[model samples]
Target chain A: MKIETKVEKFTEPLHLESGRILEEFELIYETYGELNEDKSNVIVICHALAGSHHVAGRYADEAKPGWWDKFIGDGKTIDTTKYFVICSNNLGSTFGSTNPLSIDPSTKKEYRLKFPVLAISDVVKAQMRLYDRLGIKNAFAVIGGSMGGMQTLCYAIEHPTFAKHYLAMATTAYTRPWAIAINKLAIESIRHDPIFKNGFYKKDDLEASGLPGLAIGRMAGLIAYLSPGLFNRKFGRDYASTDGLYELFGRFEVEKYLEYNAYSFPKIFDPLSYLYICKTMNIFDAGRNKDKLADSFDKVQGKLHLISFSDDMLFFPEEMEEIRDIMIELGKEKQVTYKMIDSKCGHDSFLVEVEKFKDYVSEILKD
Target chain B: MKIETKVEKFTEPLHLESGRILEEFELIYETYGELNEDKSNVIVICHALAGSHHVAGRYADEAKPGWWDKFIGDGKTIDTTKYFVICSNNLGSTFGSTNPLSIDPSTKKEYRLKFPVLAISDVVKAQMRLYDRLGIKNAFAVIGGSMGGMQTLCYAIEHPTFAKHYLAMATTAYTRPWAIAINKLAIESIRHDPIFKNGFYKKDDLEASGLPGLAIGRMAGLIAYLSPGLFNRKFGRDYASTDGLYELFGRFEVEKYLEYNAYSFPKIFDPLSYLYICKTMNIFDAGRNKDKLADSFDKVQGKLHLISFSDDMLFFPEEMEEIRDIMIELGKEKQVTYKMIDSKCGHDSFLVEVEKFKDYVSEILKD
Candidate 1:
């Protein structure tokens, strides 16, 4: 299916969890399938960091369908034909949304570091406003993984009756210390780059040289997103070429693979947006400011399905199990389901190993 | 046990595995305890990346002991009372050995990137030369962990009769793709820094500014050296400061910990040495010229003990098991012993959690 991105303008101030406000902003989103007359078949899809509103379907000019095209086509797992899927580009994301790269209405200049720090809850609130404007009173389901999963949980807790089913995949209820350290590495890597110019580099300059520091950050982040088993199976000890084995700058097949994927990232993605998103992820504590962690679960009225991958080191299966355990302790196990899928793809399994969880998703949608 | 570093000059040409030659070089080493008559009590210790000859005891100016002081002092696991310990800085390391920072005799300039890419075999050979000069023949044991472990394995294979026992811990026979990818991240992180100046930055400039890029690399490397379980237990979701929770650049307790450790690394470590060592590690294949991996182990004439950590993501327990399994397949099971120590510290377990394996070392030394 071919789809077009749509933008909606809102003048009302968006009060963020950080106590900052975004006075005027635009929500960029895409929809798949048609909205049913009753609008009960709506499914809101949240995107991870570096992800966009284009979750599935093809554009007129692109060859690749979407980041998650595999599970959302006509007869695919998500079955776009039955459900009207809505995915809005997250606030602070670089993908055609009013992010750090967007021109500030008051200053008439790019926000850059001037953009207020965002939280997962703030991003969810912005999306909720879009949902309100789209006339989506009560959606059939809400689905996401990673940072998106955090947004899904916020939706379930903060707005208890918005979505009937909430599917959070490969995520944690809060950003743990291990993951926080990883994010710090990425941010510092970008910050150390001279070309970054304190996040005020010209777009043309960034396009010319590309942020090597950002590339390094991306490379490190990519490794965390993948399992060592997957890497061992994919590249082993293979060389990039035969001649440079003994050279100081020799390339391994794995290094080449990472470089190819990482180096090209900075050319398209904005550095400030990347930095902000990392902060947003690091401070994601669902139970923050609550007397008890179970209090966060007590507010959830939706059927919360926490799906995790066995090999995901960044957000371990135990993290998702903690959410379920909290719900169980609160005698709300009937409202929460936790499933850990066997996968070697690690955290990226949610996007690439859809077959492992598709039947379960179909069953949930059936309910 | 107070110790001082000693340096010895060698005029003889050292042929490297890369077919390059070091015409003249200096080896820096340290010794502890007493060398018995006939030098039969000699125990050589190999240090890993960023490690030096200072394997035990304290210098006059320092308050802390050596990196492995816990297991190397008198009546300790290695038992200095019964053995004389020797540790030499590895060939491309920055710790007082002739590394990239060393002056090239021909040009009177620092070698920098001109330093020949070293293999683990080259490092072992250099240590062997130091052993010969010290009048130590067929020492009781050769021991090390991580890169040091790689050197121990090299000693077992290349100089089979050099030591009676070889103890290699938390290491691999070859640098697999997973580790190669990680090393690439570190090298690239330093390379991306503008101040790195392609490894030619002036010493004064480096001292003044410090390589932020190198710090980022170290931060990433440190995380890999430790397990997520350790980080969770140590830092959890604690904040660096309570006031900056919603700030974009607010630090987590984990971030502060990493920053404190990582930022100080570049001040002392050389970026070029870091890059060269990473390269050396990536291309370390024991069976490089051999027809089969088993052929490399076939030359082992001494008892080989392979130790691994349960939570080591860098070098998995399965990797050490592979070495033992290869020996068993060759009908040389009697020649090798494999032990996996349960620890949450990951690769650093061999260094910090020596108590867990000290008794085993005592038993092995008794033979």
Candidate 2:
């Protein structure tokens, strides 16, 4: 069931760490539940790649509920009755936030590629301004998975005193070579398209971005989502038939699923947006930011819950263990806990797998 | 030192098991060493995808040496002084063999895609005829890797008494789902190319049947020829610094290798010829012809040597072991020896890995 939530547009001119001032920084967000008298029940929900502020409910008359609606209802993991939840579209996101498609006040045109390349830290920093404006001193917990997990770590490292708990799920501290390679291929798919005009094309021409090139992008993403065991389970050279006509007709169900994903991406996503967001995500490195792992975690004043997935090849389970190991070395062991969720969905288990993730969430939050 | 070999062409009209008469089946081949008195020293080397009869030494008056020059000459593992070696370009191959690009006796024009869709067995059948015509009673070994490996297995199954040794490398009894999936994508790359014309385009346009498609095809092949460890070792997301002034460059040396292979293929290869040859290789199945594994090997003339490389994601080591296990089951255990090469090069180790392959050959010959 879709929960009811309130959304309001809050615009504030914020000074960036860079000397330049974003004169009209705007934030779009949705909120659920009531704040306690001491405001200690406030929980922050962060998003991974391609997520928006619509976290738990129907936006007034919209039929489609939020992406995380399954996990944020009254009795869900992020229970609305116990915690006041807030989710916002980060500043550089194409969702409701001011992004490349936003008009620059000085030039009065879409920033497009002209928008300054954003880092996850920059995104987190912008959200901090939103938090300050909302009078939230510290969130009871900051929880996220995948790219959102990266943002949670960045927030905790940057403003540890303001975060009581940090739960990171199925994420890496920084992007790796394999992921960057896939990202490069994905971006190249769009840029090399005959009609892709480097983001200046009209909205009508933008639809072409999803055809063959974007289809390949979705394919690349699918590879990271599923496990080899899944592939083995589904199709093991069991052809449709022996006449050479059956395999010719349709053999592997995996191929059909990939085609579906490729066909669907263009309707919901823009190629340029994918490019920009990928770059921002890649440059996000908390250890690099603070010079060392210990230094990065030292500033954190929050409990860290580092969660990994057994089948997450994109962000390997070993990487998550490394993060936990680092937190221990930094003498923050008391504030840290590591949980691993075993699933066959690989990197995409966080989003695609429901029941298993729900059970894991229940166990993690029980204490 | 390079050993000179005589090259010649032979043609014969053969009746296929399919009840179709293959008339004037032309074969271009090279032979080294004098035939033994009993025609029993013959070692036939089957070519893999896109390879030819020039297994050793350069063509007469040619600038470039043959593919396996380092391992196939004089006192090599096969030992030309004691053994006669024959390498014939497979039928349906673009190399100087009877192919779609060759003139059809019926039409006088290139057969194009009209060439009978071939199976791996067909190629072996034609080679067997070549053997019979040459007055060879037995082959010392039928050795090959990849598609060539398919032929080795086919030779063993189809004429158990003719080939005494089956040295199959980097191949399977049948094409697995992973290989078929990649091959299907490559075919789609060629078929969906606007210039393909469903195999009935203008003669000049037929040249365009698969240019850019060559990229995807070779890219897929390159994946087979590489190990993930080797690719990660060699590439690891290293990229050329473009400075945003020119088109993006390939991310890794391996990617560049694939691009070069892709570009090279379209320059020389006939699109229809590629399709026919790959299709033959894809459907190659020794397992399909016989019910039990022993029934499949019951016809094999002699010993079997199965070789695989470590870290070969394409022809996974697991599949190679399966063939070896089957060979051991039927009291042919003494005749079958399996060796897994410890190399990071993966399946391509068969080609670029000269010293190791040569050593293995010497060791096997000593046995």
Candidate 3:
């Protein structure tokens, strides 16, 4: 299947949860399948950090399918043939979205660090605006994992009737302290890059001198996303002779794997956008102003399907249990269901363990 | 009690496990209590990464006591009244020891990156040379935690009769892949600092510009050294409004704590030394060059006391179990004992939860 990205411009001034306003912004999105006459068959798919509008299918010039290609194609778990899937790039991401790389109309220059700080709710609001523009009054479901899951939860709470089903995978209603510490490390890594220059460096210079810091941040994040069991099983004491001398810098395969992924990340991702997104993630609290999590969930009328991986160290299963227990205590047990996927892939299980959840997802998406 | 550092110079070249050699080096150490006439009452205490010779007691001009002062004073756990204690700065650290910051006699300049890459065995060997200089043929016990524990294990395995008792705390006989990954991040953080300039920058410039990277590295390492329960209990989402406005960079108490420690680290630590030490840690495998761990322990003759924290994520109790199980399989279980310290302090429990283990230490050290 082939897909193309489309842009929707919201010219009206938009207010952000951070109390900052954007005069105008554009959302980049891709759609699959046909929308029903009532526009009620639309499923909004939110992307995680580093993900983009391309959730499934390949573009004409692209060699690879979308990030969620396995689960969203025809006859797949999401079954694009049965539902219209709309995946949009979140705000503060560099993937053709209104992010730090986007130009500021007033300054006629890239926003860079001047870009408004965003909350997960802001990203959800932008998607809701896109839905309104596309005549999607009610979505069949809102589904995502990690940062994407944050958006799904936000949509379910803020717009109770906007979706019939909400699926959150390998994520939490609020960022925990440990996760916040990891995010802080990543943000500091980018900020400490000498060429970052307080996020004011020229794009080329930033990419040049800032890539190492970005790579280091990604490496650190990757460690959190993986389980020790998986790493040991995959690369236990296996040495790679880097210089043919079998000496210092001769690395274990897992270390090489992390370094490779981290080094490659800067080629496609912007460090400033990464910092902003991580900051937004760090402040994610579903019940920020509410008295408790139960109160926050009171407005979420959509049936909730919470999925967590057993080996996920970043968003542990205990975190998912916290949300489930809160819902149970609020007498919302009938409206919520929790599932734990037993896998050694850790937090990345949401992306890699699709086969493990294909049947459960299909059952939940059924009419 | 007031204590001071004493240096021991080894003019003979030291050979490292990495096939590198140091022409000459010095060990900065501190001692408490008097050596017995037979030189059989010495207890060698190894310091962890970032730890120094000041294991106990305060210096005359200092406000704070040694890092492990609570556990190593006159009548503390490793009581100085009964056993003469010697704590030496490990190779590849910067605390007045021969390290990357030390001068090369031939070059008349700091060794910097020119310092030989070292292993735990190399550090143990250096300490053994110090013992030879002091005319101590055998030690009553070799005790340490974390990297210090690694040294204790090395001393036991490499010099079978050098110590009568070996206590390894919150550490492993081999560095796990996950640990290597974390260490890699720390090493890369230091190397990526542009001011590091491949470890050739002027000392002042390196300290000023490279401190952020060093701090970031420390922050990352600190995360592993703590448990989530401790963070939740200690700094649970309490926000600090910097600049009198809750905005971007407004931090949680935990973030501030990590940042403060990270920022303060460079004032006393060297990035090159950090990298070298982390590299050494990454290669710490007691079974290295041996077909199996049992083969490595074949020569070990000391009575073993293995201690692990229940909540230590870095060196999990499972890791300690692995070593204990290996000893059991080799019929050395009678010579070994294991203890789990139930604490929320994680890897730092060995240092902070001294009260929990004072009696245990005293019992084990008693003749």
Return the interface RMSD of the candidates, in order shown, one decimal each: 1.0, 4.7, 2.0
Question: Which residue pairs collide in model 2, if any?
Answer: A160-A301, B160-B299
Q: Which ten residues in a row have the lowest lDDT in candidate 2 chain B?
A: B242-251
TM-score of each model, in listed order: 0.98, 0.81, 0.96
Query: Given the true complex, what DockQ would model 3 score?
Result: 0.63
* Per-residue lDDT of candidate 1, residues A92-172 (tens digit): 898888898888888999888889998899999898889889888999899999998999999899988998999999999
lDDT at B69, model 2 = 71
> Candidate 2, overall lDDT?
0.70
The Cα RMSD in angstroms, rounded to one decimal, for candidate 2 relative to the true structure is 4.9
| Segments of candidate 3 deviating more than 4 angstroms | A207-210, A242-246, B1-4, B106-108, B207-210, B242-246
lDDT of candidate 1 at residue A360, scale 0 to 100:
85
Which of 1 and 2 is the better model by DockQ?
1
Q: After superposition, how far is residue B71 of candidate 3 from its true place, in Å?
A: 1.0
User: Candidates sorted by lDDT, descending order?
Assistant: 1, 3, 2
Runs of candidate 1 exceeding 4 Å displacement: B2-4
- Residue B317 deviation, candidate 3, in Å? 1.5
Hey, what RMSD does candidate 3 come out at? Answer: 1.9
Lowest lDDT 10-residue stretch of candidate 3 chain B: B240-249
Clashing pairs in 1: none
* Alpha carbon lDDT at A68, candidate 3: 93
* Chain B TM-score in each of the candidates: 0.98, 0.90, 0.96
